[model samples]
Target: MTFDVPDASYYGALITNDSFEILVRKNANTGEGLFLRWPHDSDTRPDLLVQSCLDKEFGVNAQLIEGYDAIVFIKGGSLVNFIVHYLGGDIEAVGLQWVTLKTAWELVFKLEDHEVLLSDSASLGVLDRWIRNRRRKIAEESFDGEQKKWLEKFDRLCDRVRYVLGRDSACYGGDGLYSEYIKSIISSAISTMKEQEDLDLYLNDLFGRTSKPGRSAAREADLIQAIHVSLALSSLDLYNAEYTNHVKECRRVLGFLVALENIYGSSSLEIRRRAIEGGNGRWRGHDKAGRIKSDQIKVGQVKSIESAILKVLEDKKLYRKSDRVDVIAGKIAGAVQGEISTLGLGDFFVDKDLQLFIWHFISENKVARGLIK
Candidate 1:
């Protein structure tokens, strides 16, 4: 089905590049609509909406818009997909974005105005919260489902390759080494992984350091893990805790060897094996494939980031209002900004917007429920 009501949407140019920008008109919905913001109708096709929005916002003789990318960022719905899907064959997505569950909740409460789209105010109360929560949960679960399928495939590969004779595939997760390895990486592999006692022990071991992991550290961790998993899938090194951990963290790696096998068949595995053996001591072959989606912060850049981050944290309190909180947010934002800049994506947002983007990202992606040793 399609949207059944008329709602306002802001339209802008989405440049896809090393440094991309969504050329949005500031105050897009204000009166005397000088900007490219207009109506979205439930039953209308995107081309029609695009044409109408342009005609209404600009003038009778506004030039025909062509050869540009379209970006449809909606509140909490999959309307982006519908628009992208129905926008016809010519349209292409310039980029992808994900928001944290915290940001999702904030948006729902702060900005989601349902009156224009939904007549029932009843649906806007608890129902609205449920809708958003469920949407997020469903997405997470769907990813888990895919992981489960891959996991099963992975277990069988071990059954065939490792020759754990007559061992039930279902029990691979229970193996001591497997559990130790997977739990270290998969995160959600064991639901009730640890309690508070275990976490305190782990934290105490670190001497109560509150400093968050830097983006550079995270990037390096991500890179090493990627290569580790590729090597594991290629059967180069499975006993190493690194590859064992990685094979279970398929989502964070944005699809994995299983996906490749699905598309290219078992030949992909053989190719990967060849790549691994050829690389020898040096990084090469399948091990070198894929990347961390975010830009990496290098060791030399750390000094520069430290001062820059501390400055932001110390000075500003427009909303959160606490130096401590600001510092925390600043660290998160600064790390995010570093990732963006390194990836050549700084043009998408200013400093403040980038901070908010990071806040949302951290919340939506990871949720640590209990402590772990």
Candidate 2:
């Protein structure tokens, strides 16, 4: 059945401090009377009553009254029509309560830095009163099962949201994206528990239906949410570590690239001279040294060498070991020295193999993939 809200302001104006008698007009044939009484005081006006009713209905504390008088009034009404007419329609009354509860839940969870005001002692009392009132109504023969189910759903949603945002911890490990979704499910379960407890007392009182005293689906969900949250956090930590290592690797590569460029840009004679000096008193040959030190290569020479080294280092299959730079550099140096022998500067380039090996090692070890972009 639909309900129509009364004009609270108009009715409030009718109540006066003088306590003057208000008339009750009875329809003799219908045996119905319209009873009217003035508000007790300025503070006890119809607006105050409406506000109190709203607060109690939503399981929130109202500063209007000292206790749960508003809830008492609503639950005290006859089964045919609740006293909601004094305030408004059933839809408005229920809507207002739902809004208030939702608002309170948001406030509780949103303020991560602050304690939940809804859990305050004063607020808990109000919530208790609301729960008791609902229980009483549910126990009555006039109670609607559908309405109860709706209320239960609302409560469950609010509770779940609250738990998810309120608690700090982890529950499991998995991919970052999947972890968050699982965490949400866990939060849903936790919230369900809170809602179920509130409903349990009423259920027991009305239908003698007792809830099993242990963790169930709801608890399992909470656990899963925690696991997911934990997994996400852990994944973030691992990602950051990998990123740091990449940067270091990049820097090392950059250093090696600079060295290779410098070496390749120099004339063959200059390279031969450096190699001879590096060998320290070793025999040097003009043709071999010139071949080893040839600077006739283009930019592509350096690029090709660097690219090959990077590719080798990055390939997990090529470098099974975690240390990538050393292996790539060693292999490149050996290959370059072998190529130099055919260039016919083998005599001038003293200790060509050793020089090439050292150059490759220095370049390979200079930067790491972990340090690079």
Candidate 3:
């Protein structure tokens, strides 16, 4: 189905409130572009990252050539660091300059930053702005009273489109771009704009389908339109995948807690439950039985966690090992690092969360993968 983007020219003017700085990696290997971060962590190749918004994130209807910046968020840090790290030790921090959502969105239309890489059609903003400005000047100088009134009505419709897209003044395209190709739903008639959740679902469904583009694929312009649609749709998919993975982590944590409670004899079931729900405060101290119960959960022999886990492998007959826990500990630590992105408790992730994540990691990576006995 064709999504008629209401006042497509107006979307160029849409702004976003929250913005941040990011590192835009430049990949020297592919000679293609920077190595952008993927939304989901992979179980297969936990190291190899994938996905790109610049190529296909504006939805299947509005694919435009844009650049991507590696945006990393670390806990308890004020600034989300942005750096372009070349493997050969050439690292550019991008000056840690704040880029607005509008500035980021401007990538779709135009990227003003001189140091940033420019796509072949990077001047979309400039070209479109010139067109809009010319049209506006014509309307002001040559239009009749009725024609002027129509321009005013168009402006109002554009405002409505801006609101529907959840854009603030800070986003981008304060100027206008006349998009002749994409159809937009009219402003007043639009009862409701498609929610982000709906956008996410649509993208997921679209990704799995191999059907042709909604528009004709024959024409150059039409083919270009398909690219935009593909990007926007894929971007939504990437955005949704992250949240879905986070929820999956939450569930994994819950299952791990339940299993540990059963195996370890319930040291702090309440804390486990709280962490599962949402981390509010610290969960520490001890139980009435004088057991160690706190924010962290350990599942090993009283003296060595490494020894305890290594025994599991030995018991399963996966590997014959001596009493040396450090051997397996090194490998286990690498696996754990892949699962728990950050240390300590995060917004929805607790240490117990990591505990469960490690459980599922082993279950899938080892047991399910059939790598071990």
Candidate 4:
């Protein structure tokens, strides 16, 4: 099923269970006319056509249609059956419907008059504020619940792994002994801080201490735990006290592990003599240099983590802003600039019209991403 579309033009195909629509537009920058309608409709609505496609399915294929003309496709009748038979499923159909909905929504909202009305209306101010606050609360509660669940699962894993390491002499013998010994030490430390009150005090003390390099590591652990708890609470909104308690307990365990790691290096020299003389004496002189090196690698892999975290925070801020759409558009503009720079196009022509064109494309894409929610 295929149809021929012109070159150097943008085409959007919206296929549904019963009907299909195809729209074709000239250069998105030149304010050219658009042709749109159901394939069978001879009298189509030219005014309803959009300058750019806003569907996620279509936006994802932006590069494919960027400067191309002509699209060939067959819609209706056995076309869908052919699609299902050829593709082996209806996932693409679902995705296409999602894009169609988004495209329709964008067409309604992107009107110049609607933009003016939104900008000039005083009542919209109060409505926007109320919506923002409501959304923030919902996001926070959702996050809390998710955080609690994740923390409980993480704690259970830590406990099980620690127990296995403690009992399995065969697996932890030789060079893996140091990791096992550190695990034991951490497990013991965690046992000592059984209560949340004790754990909180320990974390606060570690946060205040500055004399030891170990304190820096401990402080980082505490900060990371706090951030994790905050994000989880904000994101998950877990109402179960058991889950929250388990998360707190997991934080305690992580703090203990960080402290133990700080005390024990990768060498046998770092292990206490008493530990070597214990029943696990056969595992003495085991090295953990590789484990330490791996941890170093993880710590060094910061760029992607930082970028993702910052993006999340920026998105949250945008959502919280009074003018979320505008703020997001600004972010998208900045993102486009950064992307262009990465492509070595920073020195290219700095045309306002071209920049605006790119910004529109990015903003439409962002809106499409949001609609997936």
lDDT for every model?
Answer: 0.30, 0.31, 0.28, 0.31
Could you tell me which 10 consecutive residues in candidate 3 have the lowest summed lDDT? Answer: 8-17
Tens-place lDDT per residue, model 1, 1-373, is: 3333223353221111111111222332232111133344568664456555544443222222231121223333212211211121111231123232222222222222322111111111212233333443443464455554444445444332211111111111222122222323333312222433585464343322212232232333333344234324333223232344545443323332232222222233333222222212222322223212223434334333333444443433421231122123323453546654764554545224344333322222222001000
Off by over 4 Å in 2: 1-103, 108-121, 132-373
Highest TM-score scorer: 1
lDDT score for residue 349 of model 4 = 24
lDDT of 3 by residue, 1-373 (tens): 2222211110111111112222232321232222232333234221111112222332111122222221212112111111121112112432112233244333322323211222211222233333345446754686566545544543443332222221211223332212221112222112122443586575444333423323221222222222234323322332344434433433332332233223223345443333322221222231322223343444332113322333344443322232111112222433443323343222223222323333333322334224333
Model 2 alpha-carbon miss at residue 172, Å: 24
Clashing residue pairs in candidate 1 are 3-42, 100-360, 100-364, 101-364
lDDT score for residue 11 of model 2: 20
| Candidate 1 Cα RMSD (Å) | 19.6
Candidate 2 to native Cα RMSD, angstroms: 33.9
Q: Arrange candidates by lDDT, highest first: which order? A: 4, 2, 1, 3
Residue-level lDDT tens digits of model 2 in 1-373: 2233232222211110111111111221121212221223346545455445444543323222222221111111211112222222343233222222222322222322211121121122233234334434543345355534433432343232322222211211111122222345445544544565565563334222112232233432333333333333333333344434434433332332233334433455344333222221122222544534544544444344444444444544422232222223333343444444444433323332333333333333445343321
Quote the lDDT for 135 in model 3.
48
Candidate 4 C-alpha lDDT tens digits along 169-258: 222211111122333444444454564567667656644542245433344344334323332332222234455555565555455444
